[model samples]
Target: VGCFHQPSIVLADTDTLQSLPKREWNEGFAEIIKHAGIRDAAMFEEIEEVAQGVGDLPALIQRNVAIKARVVEADETETLGIRALLNFGHTLGHAIEAAAGYGGMLHGEAISLGLRAATWLSLQKSGLAAADGARLLRCLAAFELPLKLPADFDSNALLDIAAKDKKFEQGAIRFVLLRALGDAFVSCDITAEDMRAAILHLHEPV
Candidate 1:
């Protein structure tokens, strides 16, 4: 048996972000973009603005927290699948992290690639417009996140690992994909072959 609990309150001191290296500082932007992609489409413009210049960092962090809090509070234990929206790029991200042997590659870097894969999948499976997907890519590029699959990454190994993700249920992958900017949903329609194709597409050498 497992227990789930939400803390009485969640707090962050954005000032502490000053000490992180630029890599660490930028990592969470992936998740911020994910949150905006899935829930707050309007934030996408704000993100674009921030990319060109700094914005209200503290306010932006709180806005992200609020987006996540709403999703979590609605489906506390993931029983409703609502919280799975949070896994938008993590389906393949975790596999890539493991493929990297858990070192050298940062979690967010793996996720940026995973985000690319998911965005590609969305274009095919969910009617996501090329322009929408391009916007997402620009966000990743703006952060200088890796957009290519690491050359050493093995597709078969990545698939095998992804199959074991928590998002898989009854041997089906509930892959998260976007329908449009600011919209995402879990999909059981994705297949290993589809994932493989996306992996190869990423080998284009960005």
Candidate 2:
């Protein structure tokens, strides 16, 4: 499986979103926020504006697809770490999802918590301004996604799941941290304690 394949021409029909449950419909916005946070800061204003009500679905879908398309185009097989940037929130998010036993939590909800943790880590490790990080979280909140970790969350269990994740390579954790809004980079310096701190930080009142 050395080759990579993607549709030469892809189509997005925003009208189909009408069929999703209200909760299901909102799940995708977390990804849109992820795209804005990592690759297109300019989209934040539009996101905040549009999320309040469906301001423009087609444009938004196209933008999210375009961001992902560019990332894949740069590293079709993830041979380089550029594709890792797309996992900015996934590292921790997936752990929560797996710990919750998959159907236990909505994928978007778990990811919302992970994005919050990643943003907080960005503030601590990457010199991302507190305001900028808050803004990113605000975008997630705009979609009514869950920011706080579930009260019953098992950190050790989550960490164990994280340890087995594909994101971990060798002995280092290639966590994606943002130097600034729209500027995300993978870091190998994150320790288990730092991850614990972020998980605990989510329990604080926001």
Candidate 3:
């Protein structure tokens, strides 16, 4: 048997993935969210450390090790599961951003908003504790991730876009819910009306 080309691996010593293009920085960050087990304080501390000195390659790569582990452990079934988790906030998120067009919002930023909405739903459907939801909200805020939809976005178009996400099964969209930090599961029974209400409520002021 012959192996073709080099295996893609994220270097634990280097701050970057040698095989990955520089343009994929955000793509790398996308893996960060899945490691929900890491405390928010440590995660933000790493972010701050990176901001202070991007030249510290070792520390940056160390922070991303768990992400690499997940990817390395990925098989067909687990890969799909991870990908599905990544799509958590993507339903309404992608549509709002696409309709608003580029320069309006970054992809991760939009998805962050979606994550918040999904987490909100998780609280209702998956027994997510109030403290966990609050912590998630705070962590997203610390990362400067969005927690609300843009004011100009159209609700129906967003819903249509979300509906088209492949996570939908038998015509119902499935969502990943966090039962707690470090634990998440998926379900499709959440109604659109409730989802939309959650999104809308997140946008409203106290």
Instruction: List where candidate 1 sits over 4 angstroms from the true fold.
Output: 1-5, 169-171
Candidate 3 per-residue C-alpha lDDT over 1-206 given as tens digits, one digit per residue, 9 for 90 to 100: 65434346554534346566533444334335544522232454455444345435465556557454553456334445654554556666676667667787777677667677777788777887888777666656555566666576677776777667666676667776677766665676877776677668557541
- The order by descending TM-score is 2, 1, 3
Candidate with maximal TM-score:
2
Q: lDDT at 19 for candidate 2?
A: 91
Q: Write the per-residue lDDT of candidate 1 for residues 1-206, one digit (tens) a residue.
A: 98877667778988898899999877878888888888888887878777787667777788898888889989997899899899998888888888888576899988898999999999999999999899988988898888998677788888888887766676568998999988888899787788888888888864
- Compute the lDDT of residue 120 as modeled in candidate 2: 93
lDDT of 1 at 91: 85
Residue pairs with backbone atoms closer than 3 Å in model 2 (clashes): none
In the order shown, the candidates' Cα RMSDs to the true structure are 1.8, 1.5, 5.2
Off by more than 4 A, model 2: 169-171
Encode model 2's per-residue lDDT on 50-116: one tens digit a residue.
8877567678778888899999999887889899899989899988888889488898888888999
lDDT of 1 at 181: 82
Q: What would the TM-scores of all predictions be?
A: 0.93, 0.94, 0.70
> For model 3, how many clashes?
1
